[model samples]
Target: MNKAEIIVALDVPNAEAMEAKLQEMPDFIEWYKVGLEIFCAEGPAVLEPLKRRNKKIFLDLKLHDIPRTVGNAVKTAAAHGVNLMTVHAIGGRAMLEEAAKAAAKCENPPKLVAVTTLTSLSQEDFVDLGISRTVSEQAVELGRLCMASGIDGMVTSAHEAKALREAFPDALLVVPGIRMPEGDVGDQKRVASPSFAVEQGATHLVIGRPILQAEDPSAAATAMLNDMNK
Candidate 1:
């Protein structure tokens, strides 16, 4: 069986803490996720060091905007040479297609992924947004939009992974709402263990907290990868 690819989320606020956390990461960690927090705070310059080490970057800015505008933003991000980037499927097919087209122009385009539904939300949260479908239903709809847009992959919670994998068996299914057994889940409402996600056909696992907050970040990451490869 193919072990799920492991990518740690660099959710820290600034470059200093990011470097510290990275130092604690095991050498086996070749893929890293740079989310909005650090990207907004430090800009693309923050990614230079990781690129120097040849680490694959998942620039999770979750771009959601008008089609032309999001396409421009995606072009800029692609210029940064990131390995993966996210655009929200909620932005609609026009926006997603624009982003994909922009990436295709790059000599080394980042894999354009669609952000389906955020894992932090619950069913009650969807009602607040006037969304009639359940989170799973919404994810399925957005995932199909991603497929129609010619996007390369998707970002969804593991709870919805099986459904997505069934729909797009060849697409990169990256799940982020992961909490190891007995770990604090914090704001994420739809979460699962790394093993369950992998078993459900998640291609990559974007894990944070449990690994980054541990006293031994490298060891924590190794353990998680161990679980992924088991």
Candidate 2:
């Protein structure tokens, strides 16, 4: 078994809603992704509850900015004691390098991963933005840049996980937009099942709707874990 971890995304509107969702989840779920909605609503204080639970936090801010600003944000996240965090790979080499250096200075640095392309985007969307490369190409190209710039890993679709793993065998490949075979795709355009993501070499699987919105969130999470660990 690959032992790929399941990271439940807390996609709720506020800290209260997020706490309710966490209460619904099983204790076996060791990781949680604290994204923009809840983080922005509650600020750094939003992480306190999860810290009390001793759960690992994946802060999915997808930070994008100039070198100095992003570096400062990285330092702040490190201070918050996140286990993992994301920056936009499109932010380019200088920003990525600065983010890496900031992490290196932390006593307990969070593993910094770069976002290659969002799972909600289609290839046509890239074309609309005047980019000629396919989603996979762009992901791999950015993955290379991330490694060269000292980023620890990347957030990519499972569609590109295999290529990324092959190119950078040691890089942490975090795959989001995970949906069960029978589950609704919702807003994500490039989605995969838990088993598919694990088999493709994803180190962490980020699932939101399927598990969080299920009638029995704990059972749903256990089932997804079974699928990934199979």
Candidate 3:
């Protein structure tokens, strides 16, 4: 329930799948993230159960749209009592600002986080996307923009966590792309162990497959928490 175990990414298919994992929820992992897949399949209905359990929620919709649209979207998300939410920094400063402002208006505003370059993207991927800068460079630039726009945090790879912490010491760094030492990489290109991520100054680590796909998810989650404590 401490800051170190602040968030856990639930990248499963739907509420049913997520509920299966919820049975394995450890006391240490208090926060849960509802990403695109789960959101698209279950909508706000899925959130009710988590809310009843009094678990903090992070709605990872990764909203990317024009300023006005994104602002309205954030307002709706905030009303749902989510503790955190994400927007794509690629949506630009105007969109980021609008999202932040919308959340701020909520009686219990969710922390607005901007997603920089995705963990699945490599330097070559950036080149293929016609971006001249390296992924790290793009991440830093996007992070800076998000901070200026009053965002509460950023979702970045652990590879950039150190540099990002240096630039924004007080800002929360919610890192995905986390892998245990023996874990498979899956679709993520940039990854780090949970202990390494915490050592690198990440405020939160978003782990999915390693815990969710394990033979015993609660035990797996406990092991991850133990690793972070080390």
Best by lDDT: 2
Alpha-carbon TM-score of each model against the true structure:
0.97, 0.98, 0.96
* Model 3 lDDT tens row, 1-230: 13566477788888877888888878767889998888889888888878988999999999999999999998888788889899999999899999999988888988988899889899988889999997778878998999999998788888888888888888888999888898999999999999999888788889888888889888888888889989
Angstrom error of the Cα, residue 7, model 3: value is 2.4
Query: Model 1 off-target regions past 4 Å?
Result: none
Native-referenced Cα lDDT, model 1:
0.89
Ranking by TM-score: 2, 1, 3
Q: Count of backbone clashes for each model?
A: 0, 0, 0
Q: Residue 127 of candidate 1: its Cα lDDT? A: 92
Cα displacement (angstroms), candidate 3, residue 16, comes to 2.1
Candidate 1 residue 20 C-alpha distance from true site, Å: 0.9
State how far residue 176 of model 1 sits from its true place (Å): 0.5
Q: In model 1, how large is the Cα lDDT of residue 12?
A: 97
lDDT string for model 2 (195-225, tens) is 9998898999999989989999999999998
> How many backbone collisions does model 1 have?
0
Question: lDDT of each structure?
Answer: 0.89, 0.94, 0.87
Maximum-TM-score candidate: 2
Lowest lDDT block of 10, candidate 3: 1-10
